[model samples]
Target: MALFEIDESSGLPVWVQLRNRFVYLIKTGHYQPGDQLPSVRTLAAEAAINYNTVSKVYVNLESDGYVESVRGRGVFVRDIGGKADDVRSIADTEIEGCIRRCLALGMTIDEVTLRMMDVAHRLKDEKS
Candidate 1:
């Protein structure tokens, strides 16, 4: 089975849904630099997704510079890039995702603010 689960009802496109999970594996340090990813055929079979879809995901990952495909060695993780501009782009995406979920949960501005602060502090503590 795949390392992540998909929610078909989440209103996200299949590729997007898979992409987010796939990227998380990289971003979270689960897949280290030079670590090979599962073969496309293997991932496709595990996720029960189309082979084409898996190919598309790999292509995007390569285009984004997050991974590379060696001729016969399969795909491997690239050292993740985190330039200032890239950080900002990722932060914007994260903010939008958080806001959408908070809104859907009917959270008040004050509640969201507090929750954000609490989570931020907890994360900072964990890092320290």
Candidate 2:
């Protein structure tokens, strides 16, 4: 599977997308503590993003305590105490945004909830 993807049509900034994906990977244990992340240039090439943009994301991730960069070494994931609250907060914000967008499109809460659950199940099945 591809390590990263960029949705040009999502309207989200490229750096934000890369940062969020790194956060999700760290929170999901996909990249364990002390695991070295790909170098900025490598990730930029892999994700087809600008090298500067990837570097900015790395800086932001480091500031947020999700990662650390060692001199002469690459960035690595930080433990951050598992920080479930932080992860949950990020997810909550995205979920709320999606709900608001759906509501603005005239979808009821029930419809959004049902559709979200259906998609979740479908994705789970696909993964299996």
Candidate 3:
């Protein structure tokens, strides 16, 4: 199982954080179609979070067509075609929010761009 790190200090809610992590895994091919995910209880225990929190994240993913739940079995990754566009939109929205916040903080566009690049590099390194 892949481990996910949750930043309690981040502005995003825990459930959102969990959901985004799963999305990232799926997008990166860490999780593949028909692959079964750990049960909500197991995932919560491993993540050290509430079971309901994990459940809610899985439920939201299912509703978004990224995953499907099987009776008596766990959740499995679904063959969600065109999910890249959805992921891209979510990423664009997040970037826009960050840019807005940086502008509000009186940061120059160049400075914000540099910072974004630095953060992107760090994220790429972490993933590798």
Candidate 4:
């Protein structure tokens, strides 16, 4: 059975959604390294998405070193860093990159801190 269904209502691209889903599956130990993924055609038919979309997602994942494709075999997850805190590591790396870019643009530490706090506050308000 398919493990996840994409959220059609989300503004994110289908490929991005697929990529996130597979990543989460791996991180959560739902898909271990060497576990074969459903064939692209099968998955596309199941997801009711275009074949090209799923193919692109798989291709991108393979290129990102997240998955491997073997001739006459199938796509399988790769052992990427093997850290339980992989998500946090990724988030920290991306956030650090953003902070560096902001700093390069002459943004101040206090400005960035205040803006982040405001964003968090807005999120908290939304949950209320």
Query: Candidate 3, residue 81: CA error in Å?
Result: 2.0
- Assess the local accuracy of residue 100 in candidate 1 as a C-alpha lDDT between 0 and 100: 78
Task: Give per-model TM-scores.
Answer: 0.64, 0.69, 0.67, 0.64
Local accuracy of candidate 1 as per-residue lDDT tens digits, 1-128: 33756666579878888887778778767788999999999998888888898899999989988899999889999987653255457888998899779978999878998999999899656544
State residue 18's C-alpha deviation in candidate 4, in Å: 0.8
- What lDDT is reached at residue 17 by model 3? 90
lDDT of 1 at 2: 35
Note the residue pairs that clash in candidate 1. none
List candidate 2 segments past 4 Å from native: 84-114, 117-128
For model 3, the superposed segments whose C-alpha errors exceed 4 Å read 84-128
Model 4 stretches with alpha carbons more than 4 Å out: 88-128
- What's the best-to-worst order under TM-score? 2, 3, 4, 1
Task: For model 2, give the 10-residue run with minimal summed lDDT.
Answer: 1-10
lDDT of 4 by residue, 1-128 (tens): 34757776689998899989888777767788889999999999988988999999999989988889998899998887665478768888998897888788898988877877888899656544
Which lDDT value does model 4 have at 122? Answer: 94
Prediction RMSDs, each to the true structure: 7.7, 5.1, 4.9, 6.5
- lDDT score for candidate 4 against the true structure: 0.84
lDDT of each: 0.82, 0.87, 0.87, 0.84
Query: What does the lDDT read for residue 112 in candidate 2?
Result: 100
